[model samples]
Each structure stands twice: as C-alpha cells, then as structure tokens.
Target: MQNPASANANVTVTVTATATVSDFAELPATASHGPLRIEYRWVNERAGDAPIAVFLHEGLGSIAMWRDWPQTLCERLGMRGLVYSRPGYGLSTPRPHAQKWPADFMTAQACDILPALLDALSIDRDERGRMWVIGHSDGGSIALLYAALHPEALAGAVAIAPHVFVEDISVESIAQTKQLYETTDLRSKLSRYHADVDSAFYGWNDIWLDPAFRQWSIAGEIASIRQPLLAVQGHDDNYGTMAQIDTIAARVPHAQLVKLDACGHSPHRDAPEALNEAIAAFVLKISAS
Candidate 1:
C-alpha cells in the first residue's frame, strides 16, 4: 500500500503492484482524424476463452497509469483484457493546440474512433459479438456513453468514479490541479511517462472546465444502455461526487453500484483486491447468464 499526502484533507492510499510494459502486449494502433495520425497501445492477452474486457484509462491515465489491474483481473477471471491510451494521453498522439475537440468528443470516440481502433487491430465487434468495457474517470463516462449509443456492441460495462456532468466541485478541483501542474513539478513528473504531458493535461482539463461543458450530461444516454452494468465509486473521491454513479443506477435497470469506503477517484488503484474480486464475480455471473 502506498499512501500519498494530498492538498485535500482526504488523502489517497493506493494498493496494487504496478505492472511494467512486459506484462502487456504493446500492439501499435493506427487511425485517422483527417490528416492527423493517431497512435495507441493495446494489452489483450489471456490464456482462456473468457469474454474480452477492454480497459479505458482516466483523465490523466495511460496504459502505465492503470498499473497491474488489467493483468491482475484478466488473470484472475481467465479473461482477455485490453488497455490503451487515448488520443492525447501517454504515448498516443498529442492534441494540437490549433484544433479543438468537437463538443461531442466523447460521443465521437464511442461512435467512431474506438470502433476504428478496434478495426485496425482486427477485433471484429460484430463477430466477436460484444466485449466488456472497464473504464475509469473520463474513460468510464466514455464506456457508459459507448454502451448507450451502441447497446449491441457491448456485453456489459464497469465504470469507476465516472463523470456524467460537470459540477462546481469538479471545476474547483481541476483549477487546483492546474496550479499544481504549473507551479509545482507535477507536469515534469508526468513527463516521464508522457512525451507531451501538458497537451494531455490541458486538453482534458480545459475542455472539461469550459462553461458550455456544464451542459454536457450523459445521464439521458444511460437510459439507452440495455446491457448489464456496474458502477463503482470511492467514498473519498476528490474529483466528482457519488451522484455520478447514482444517476447511472437510476437509469440502467441492471446496473450494480459498489461504493467503497476509504477509497478515492480510482477504485482499481485504491482498492485493487476488492475491485478484482468484484469484477471476477461480476464477469462470472455475466458469463453464466
């Protein structure tokens, strides 16, 4: 267990072994958004025939940010798992300052980019049937949105501390993070993993804090997600409130909400044992059905 002191009184204690690149299959990904070339890495290696589980990282997350959770859970469940960095995070392409993400950036990812990436790797969504998605923070919201938009493309989804709508608290927290990134060495530290950390950080932070983004809420989309769903939240998340998961439960009929005590925004990082156990059981139940 690693306990890190934070500006917030609620400190974050993370428990899990960090995995190296060797633990994953670093497959190169290629896609196109006009003339821009997008790059990504995929980790999907399992010994058995369990359902494929795709992992989406958080706002500041990458394949490295996920640590060993993917390998751990996939091994425990005898399932295949995939972890990849999005357009602006980790080793993926940096977001150009000259261009702005569309208002429906997340929608586009779920509707277009993600499918393109899957196709690039020859993972036939229609033939493989439906793959399970395990997403954290912003990635979690993306997963939920993807399930909602393409209900037939997913077997189920698990979201951890997902953001559905912008809140005053979220904006305030991000403002503090901006200060940390600039004044402190947070940006430098992140640079070790990301080639252009600022691009990744500001790209995500700025768009989320935009005034118009407050109107960005996918709770309405949740009503359309018919697949079995699991929403997990930590009691001590500094990013967003529990309402994120509550809204999901209110909309999706088969949604299961797991609230962990003494946990934070990233449940797989803060409580890996509990998370792995829950995911294994949930996957088993789904497979049985």
Candidate 2:
C-alpha cells in the first residue's frame, strides 16, 4: 500500500519482474488528427487462450504510472495484460500547445483511438474472444463509452470511479488540482511520468473546467452497453460521489457495483488487494458463463 504521506512524493518503487513485451505502435493519421505514437507494455504474453486485459490509465496517467498493478492482476488471473499511455501522456505523442481538446475527447478515444490501437497491435476481437478493459477515473469513463459504442468487441469491463455526468465535486477537485499544479511541486512530480506535463495536465484540466462541459453526460448513451460490467468506487472518492457507479447500475440493470469503505479515488492504489479479488472473481464468473 502507498503511504498516504508519500502518495504525492517523488519516490521510485522498483518492479522486481520485467515486462514480457514492450514496444511502440505507430498509428496512422486520422481526418481530425495527425499520426500518433503510442507506448505500450505487455505481461503474461503466453496466455493466448485467456482474454486480454487492456489497462487504461487515468486522465493524468501513463504506462509507467500504472506501476506493477497490471502485471500483478494479470499474473493472478493467468491472463495477458496490455498497459499503454494515451496520446499526450508518457512517451506517446504530445498534444500541440495551440490544440484544444474537444468536449467529446473521451468519446473520441473510445470510438476512434482505442480501436485503432487494437488493430495496430493485431489483437483480433474474433480471435481473442473479445478483450476486457480495466480503466481508472477518466479511463473508466472511456471504458464505459467504448463498451457502449462496441458491445460486440468487449467481453467485460471494470470501471473504477467513472463519471457518466460531470459533477460539481469533480469540478471542485480538478480546480484544487490546478491550484496544486501552479502553487506546489505537483507539476514537477507529474513531469516524471509525462513527456509534456503541461499538455497532459492542462488539456484535461481546462476541458473539465469549461462551462460547456458542465452539461456533458454519457448516461443516456451508456445504457446501450450490453457487455458484462463492473463499476467500482471508493466511499471517500473526492472527485465523484457514489452516484457515479450507482447511475451505471440503474442504467445497465445487470451491472455490478463495488463500494469500498475507507477508499479514495484510486481503489487499485488505496485498496489493491480487495480490488484485485473483486476483479478476479468478476472476470472468472463472466468467463465461466
């Protein structure tokens, strides 16, 4: 467990085991965007028969920011795992200074970039029996959006602290983060995980704080997600309330919810063992069915 005191500290935690595979994927340019280079790492590469677990990082997260959780979870399930950085995070292509992200940024990632990355990596949906997505925070929203958009392409999804609709709490927390970035050493700390720290931070921060974003909601759209879904949230999550996952359950009748006490926004970091157990059980049950 990460000590709360050192949660934002600049300390390196070593991974005893190495990743099975690590490489870059050069994605073709799209009509709305230019070419992108994504950085990814894989674990348990030989688990060919098992469903692949794709780990999507948070708004400010990167491949390296996931630490060893992806590896540990894949090892536990005897499954393969893929962890990658989004366009503006980690070693992937950084966003241009003048570029402003659209309000539908997360939707675009789900509908456009994710599929392209899957194709680039040659992870055929038919061959792999549909991939599983494990996403956190902003990534969790992306996962839900993806499942909604491509129900046939996913076996299941584990979304931790996903936002279907923007909340005042989320805006407040993001505002606080922005203050920390400008007044504290937060920017420098985050720089270690991102190539262009400002791009990663400001792009996400600015969009969320936009007055137009207040009305943004994926709730109606996500009702279409037919894949088995597990929505997780910490009782103490500052960015969102329990309504985040509760709304998912209300919309997707079959969706399961896990509320962890004494946990924060990051269940995988704050309550890893419990999170792992829930995910393992959820995935195994779905696979058996």
Candidate 3:
C-alpha cells in the first residue's frame, strides 16, 4: 500500500461550475458508540424549493471520490445534496481494529448511521419535504434498506448498481479485488482516499466474503418500499448483475428501471452526463408527482 504520507500528498479535490455547492465543510456529529468527529458537506445553492437529495457513495467511495457530481446533480435538480464519508472511508475515521463489522453492516448503515447523519444535519421530512436517496453500489443497498425501513420518510430513491442479493459473480469480483490489494499497487492507489486503506477495504471485503453473507438478500424488503424508485444499472457491470434491479422492479411494479449500455459499475464515473441527466429527470418527475 502507498504510505500514508504519499497518499495524503497526492490528494486533490475538484468542484465544477455545474455544482450548486463547493468547498469542504464540517458538521457536528455524535457517533452512537464513540466520540469521533463526523464531518459532512452540503450542496444547497440551487435547492430552491425542492427536497434534499442525499448522495451515498459506493463501498470504496468517499466525498472526494465523488468529485463534483453531487454539486452538479443538486444544481441540476434544484435540490440540496448531502455527501459524507462513512466511518473508515475517505476522511472519516478508521473502523476500530479490534472488532469485525456485523453481518448486517449494511443494515446498520441504513437503520442507524443514516438517521444519525440526518439528525446531525437537522434534516427530516418536515424540512426537506420527503427525503430522497441516491446511492451507488453499497450505498444503493443502504438506500434500499432505508427506504424499506422508513417508507414514510422518503419521496423516492435512485439506486445505481445496488446489490439486492449476493451472487457468485459479486463474490468472485470481490475475491479478485482482495488479490489485487495484496499483490498489486491497488492498496497504494486506494490510500489516496482512505485514512486506513485496509480498514476500509477489509471492512467491506471480509463481510461480503463471509459464508453467512451468501444469504444476505434484500429482495424481500422491496414490498415494504411504497415510495417511487428508480433502479439503474450498467450492462457491462462486472460486480453485479441485472438481477439486482430486476428483483426490486418485480416486487415493486411501479419501480422504473434504466439499464445503460457499455457502462460499468461506476455509472457516474463511466457516464456522468447520462447518469446526471437521468437522475435529474427522475428526481424532478418524482417530486412533481
């Protein structure tokens, strides 16, 4: 892995003209189990009268990793955007070395951390009309879980490449990644965005590889998500298959599906314009309805 100093030295952040908000900011956070400071950013310049949209990054995502997409989307949709690094990712604190995350780490993120994050920012249905979630990869799963658990709190959600169930392909991809981190320069590359690259990687990688995780499915939870939703996936995505979005659509007939051609796991990175346009249109349509 790249040394911490080298990684820190290579860090660069960019905010685009399309972004409604820019610059790093702080939030007053109180963790459920510890006293670590949790910081967050908001893109609200164009939030005119629309509901707030929270952007949840992928398993390997960080606020910086998102570049300026959050701002762009927030501006395009005339909505507020919230972006933060979950514990152990990005500028957030590393996970406690002693304990392995529970099998339901995704569940805890949806049930616990998200709520706390909203509370820390003083956001809710009352203030933001109804909460809207835009999550990618792991964040997508958390979004689905949040919408499932708190349907009343959301207007709708957009899940980009979310995992609803475990597949051999997903596990195999993760296993390959584990190897890359160990044998290649992948860890060094990752260190640029992570305080503790192993903590961030293993926390996600280990749990997903656990035997018990094979049964980690959220397809059953879709029935409870009464809110409108948009599920987008790329055809070329190697990490997950169409089954992820298909299951949600099958369960919730009203759910909209968008399968992009030639795109990979990171739609925002691989096809930012298309992703942003689709997202902006979807959010507008749902909010107007």
Candidate 4:
C-alpha cells in the first residue's frame, strides 16, 4: 500500500474497523520523527460522534500488539477508538540506527507528536476537547503529559502502570530485558508486530536506561492537569510500583485510582474485567458532574 502520509494535509480517509484495512497519518517536521508516517487502526468508528478514545501503546507495544483490547474497550464504552503505532514502531517509520532518544522523549510525544497527529487526521477542536487518552507505561506517561500540558484538549486521561518518576526497579528490569532480548526469543516475539523490531526495542530501551534519565520525573508537572484522570497499577507489576498511581493521586487529588491484585504490568490483559469496569464508572461519574 502507498503511504497515506505522503498525501496532502487536507486529505483524510475516515479510518474504520480493521476488517482488513489500515490507515496512516503524516506528522509534521517539528514533531518527534519530523515528516514521518504513523500507522494507525480504528475501532467502533460507527459509534458516530461518540467521544474518541485514543490508545497510546506501551514502550514496546504497537497497533498489532494492542490486539483486540482497544476494540473490546470501545465496545464496552460505546465509544469510537483510535490506536496507533508510534514513530519508530510497527509499520511506521523507524528511527535512524545512530539516533538515540533524548531523556525527555515522552514529553515530546505528548506536546509535539500527538497534537500533530490529531491535526494530520483532521480531528477538530471540538473532537479534541472531548477526546480521552488511554495509555500504558511509557504511553501512560505520555497521556499524563498531554492531560497536564493541554487539559482543555482532553475530556479525561487514563494512565495504567505509568511512571511519574524514574524507578531503580524499572531500570534493572529493562537491563535484564536487554539480556533476554539478546539471548532469548523476545525480539522474535516482538517482531510479529513491528516492521523493524530493532527500532521498537532499542528506541525504548536506550532512553530508559540512559544515565541522565535517572533525574527524569513528571510528578510536578502533572499537577497542572484539570481533567478527570484515572491511575491504575498492578500490585505485582514488575516495571513499576503502586507509588506511580499514588503519586498521581497525591498530585491530582481528583484523580481516581485502582490497584489490582493478581495482576501485572499489563492490567488490560491481566484483569480486563476489573479495568473495564473502573474505566466505565469513571466516565459515568465525570460525565454526570
């Protein structure tokens, strides 16, 4: 298929269900990758005028990796959905081999790439104001950033296993993952979703482990968010701890929180029933207000 990102800015193909179709948007040069192609997929688009839920993937996740979760959530919420692979993952453009991500990469995604994408897709001001960002891990951090930086653009934000600050545990786990990637089938498994698995893997891994990243923390900034927010984490999550959500609640007192038992890093997969319910109730409560 030809890259739709190559088309004119005014051109937009209404993305519908994946039913064997895919879509792409061209982000601007000032954005992360600058003039890059971002592969995306949609769900429940027939919901028509329903609030949009944009799913931002985990560090190593992609449109394919999200599988049917976004669809399932949209169905349950009776809302339209938008899920996309970031600049260096899935069928999207890959990062240059020699390029290393900056310590504040997630910030760039929130403040730059995401807004550019919404415009490229022609999401108007009204739609943006009613949109909700649902993200996980690094993506979750991006959601928090977006909500904080541009709260008026979002109806709400959901951060699952997000990192408000750097955790030693996260660095240690990622280092071990690097070893597993080299010695085991980790790369092979991720390759099933990404066009260039190396781009997906290293782009995420390199930054989190960068020495300067130790001082990285968005906890102070997230307090600026005025939109309803939901912070969730798994008690057994290895990548982060309950403090992640705890900090969110501490900063944004109105933020709702859900900590799951018998769950891990991926709560949507580990406890979909509980997660879906929490999110549903949150939307209802906020809408009623």
Candidate 5:
C-alpha cells in the first residue's frame, strides 16, 4: 500500500459539475417502525461489474449535502456509486415526534435498514460481490458496526471522523450545536435538505445527549472486522479527537490511518481534494488485491 500522506499530497482534485438526484425509492418497514422513503442517486451506472461505493451521510447530513463527492470519487475509480439519505433526513420518511430513538439506533440502521434498502434495490452482495462503504461521522460509526456484523458482505470500508466511543468533547460540541439550532437559523438552514428538520435534528441530538448514551461504545464490536479499512480524521476536529480512529486502528490490526492537517471534523468539506485522493487510492488498492 502507498503511504497515505504522500498519496494524498501527490494527487490533485479536479472540480466537476454537480450531478442531479437520480430518483427516490421506498422500502416498506421490515421491522417494527414505519416505512421509509429513501432519497438516493446513482453515479457512473455504466461501470459494469465494478464494485459499488455506498456513501453514508453524517448526523446532520443529507443527500444534497454530499453534493458531488461520491460521483467524483467513483468517476476517478471507474466504479459505480450509491448515495442516500437515512430516515428522518433529506427526503426520507420523517420520524414521529413521540418516537424516541434507542441507543442502538445506529446498530439497527446498519444491520436492518441498510440491508432492507439494498434488498429493495436489488443490490445483492452474493451476486454482485461485496461493495465498498464510505461513511462520515454517525454514518461512519454505522459503517463500522455494519462491517463488524456482516464482514463477508463488504469489500472494504472508509470511515471519516467515526466515533467508536463517546467523548466529553463530543458531548460538548453537540451541546453547542443544539444551542445554535435553538437560538439561530440552523433549523431553517437544515430544512432545505430534510423533509422534517426537527425530526432529523432531535433524533440525533437527543440520543447523543442522553446521560445513558455516554456508555455507548463499539470498540469491542469492531475488532472482528477483517476487511481493508481506512480511518481518517482531521487534526483540528473539535467534535472528536484522533482517538476515535486511533482506537479503530488499534482494534482492527490492518486498518490504515490518515490524519489530515489543517482540517476539522468534516474532512470532506475542509479538505476535499486530499480526502478524495486518499479514498480513491485506498479503494483502488483494495480492489486490485
């Protein structure tokens, strides 16, 4: 494998025109909850038989927030891409006001919702082989859980700013964001991306702020993941420290680590060029082997 820092430093990110949303699909609730109308888009659909890259958004993120990063990365790798909005975010089904998400919400998403959505769309891993997963923040945690739970169903995983365990800084940052959401126009701004901005915001915020949630940890659970893993985080990330991906590297012996300079919690937004290059190289390296 090439040195991550050098590989990222050597590559240039080409600006590409934004891709349009392809379509939306609904998957009937396979579990106890309501049905979900997931908004998604496909990129490079003609990349026949190439491994697909599934992009998972962050806590406050949506399909629109991802913009054209997935398409850009897929085009670089000559691979297909799938980008989608989880329930209660983007154009997906909104959460009921009375419904309080459990601490295991991320687990349910990775094990249940993702599989159901993939089945609904006929992206069978058994037939098409394992696909790559690129997830950010909460979605990054979900990706780790998914890979640990279904090791055979994944080719590799790239987790950007994933949280294996909650930290004081995380809670503090979340609290600040909550305050901003309540006091500022954060809700209105988020509304442009989500069908029910409150649902999306509170669903994630409440769970993270819950006192019982401090004990939440996936460090033990992710040790079984045998796939090629790339864990990236920014040095200036306020929401989480390097310990997040560092723990992942310690657990998953073969996991590669990339610490970005002059970047923050969201490396994709702060350092898109370097992130794009790193991910493209990692994915390509794994695919070739």
Candidate 6:
C-alpha cells in the first residue's frame, strides 16, 4: 500500500468496475481485481472542451517512465490527457510477491481496471465516446483489448508495437532481457520510476518467462474492435517483429499500419516526430468523420 500522503486522494478508488453509463460503470466492469489506488496525472487538465487521451504504459512502465511523450502528443492532437501507473507498478498498489499473473492478465486490465479508473475520474460515457487510447507494447495490447470490449466507447486508438499473439522471437527477447536485468544496471535505472521496483519488474518479467504464458494471445479478440486504429512498429524492433502490427491491420481491416524506419520497440522514444505526425493525422481524420 502507498502512503496516502503521496498519492492523489481524488483518484484513489473505492468502487469496483461495476460503474454504469449514467455517470460511471467489468473485465465485463464486474470482474473485480479488488480495490486499487492508482497513481495518475492530468495533462492540459483545464482543456475541458477538448477530447481526452488516455495513456496506458508498457509492461514495465510507470507514469514517470513515459517521460514527456504523452503531454507532447496530447498537445499536438489538441486533446486533454490522462496517464496513470497501473496496479503493481509505480506508486499504485504493488503486486504481491507471491502472485503470478494469469494468462488473461492483460485482458483483465482492459476490461476491469482501466474502466474503473475512467469511472473513478468521473469520465462518463459521452467523454469515452470521444476519447482516444494510446499505448505502447503491453500497454498497446491492453488498448486493443479495451477497444474490442467497449467498441462503442472510444473514438479510436493508436497502438504502438502491440502484440496480438506471442511469437518465438518475443519469448527469446524476454529471455535475454531476464539475463540483462540480472547482469546489468537495468534494475537500478528502473528503480527511479517505481516505488516497489521489484514488484513492477518481477511481476512483469516472471510472467512472460513462464512456460504457460507462451500460449497467451489476443489475436482473435482484437477482431471485434470497431473503431479506427493505427498500428505502428519499427522495422528494427528487438521485442517484436512487424508481424505484431501487421496482424492487427489484417484482423481489424480498417486499421492503418505505420512501420517506421530506423526505429525500435518504442517509437515515441526512437522517432518522436514521425510518430507524432502519424497520430495527429489519424486522430484528425477520425474526429472529422
């Protein structure tokens, strides 16, 4: 549990995902992950008339880990923004050391926790209809799942390096990362962002390396997303191949694809200009339609 003194009292949640459309409303809003006190921040918070951009971070990411990218992109798109650290990462509740994430963990996040946060913030149905979801890596996968589950809720989504299915290469890279995390200064570096760095790191790291997690995939699931989606990837990405976005474009036929040259798993960091331009154009086109 986080010391209440440091967390945002306005955002601490006591309600379950059962919040409704009238004011607020599951992995169905009903699948409870129990109580979570999330850590979040608002960008352009006074821009009441503009649409909201909800950002979900990568597997090992926290709000601070996202740096200034969310604020920059939301500004370019003329939108307000919400960025938060999920439970078990950053200042949010830490994952119990004994807990091993189930295969449907990402699904649970999309359906259960994210909605609860939106509700906790008093972002009702109408706001959600005009909202955009932007996420990276595992966060990207959660964004896709949220759109699929609540097809009527979002304006669209920008998924950067999202995984729809597990690949041999992904498992291989994660395996290598485990080695690096132990042998290098990775833990020291990541500790700057997370209160319980081990909770954030090991919770994410242990799951991907688990043999059973190899079969985890949302490939068939994302096919249900009805909104416009832009899938971006770097040709040189070490974590996943272009097949991640390609699969999204194929499954969600209207989904646009942007494969960046000389980029890696994190486009916002590697190619900010190109990524910002692509997302701005996509949001503009969708908003006008």
Ranking by TM-score: 4, 2, 5, 6, 3, 1
Cα RMSD, model 1? 8.7
Model 4 agreement with the true structure over 230-282: per-residue lDDT tens digits: 99899999899898899999999999999999999999999999999999999
Poorest stretch of ten by lDDT in candidate 6: 18-27
lDDT against the true structure, each candidate: 0.73, 0.85, 0.77, 0.85, 0.82, 0.82
By TM-score, the better pick of 2 and 6 is 2
Show model 2 residue runs off by greater than 4 Å: 1-22
lDDT of 3 at 40: 58
The model with the greatest TM-score is 4
- For model 5, give the RMSD to the true fold: 8.3
Model 2 C-alpha lDDT per residue in residues 143-207, reported as the tens digit of each score: 99999999788888999989889989999999999999999999988887777889899888989
Name the regions of candidate 6 deviating beyond 4 angstroms.
Answer: 1-32
For residues 117-152, what per-residue lDDT tens digits would candidate 3 score against the true structure?
676555745864476888999999888898999877
Residue-pair clashes per candidate, as listed?
0, 0, 1, 0, 0, 6
Judged by whole-model lDDT over C-alpha atoms, candidate 3 comes out at: 0.77
Better of 3 and 4 by lDDT: 4
Residue 128, model 4: Cα distance from true site in angstroms? 0.9
Better of 3 and 4 by TM-score: 4
Pairs in steric clash, model 2: none
Cα lDDT for residue 267, candidate 3: 95
- lDDT, residue 257, model 3: 92
TM-score for all models, in order of appearance: 0.86, 0.91, 0.87, 0.92, 0.90, 0.89
| Model 5 poorest 10 in a row by lDDT | 1-10
lDDT of 5: 0.82
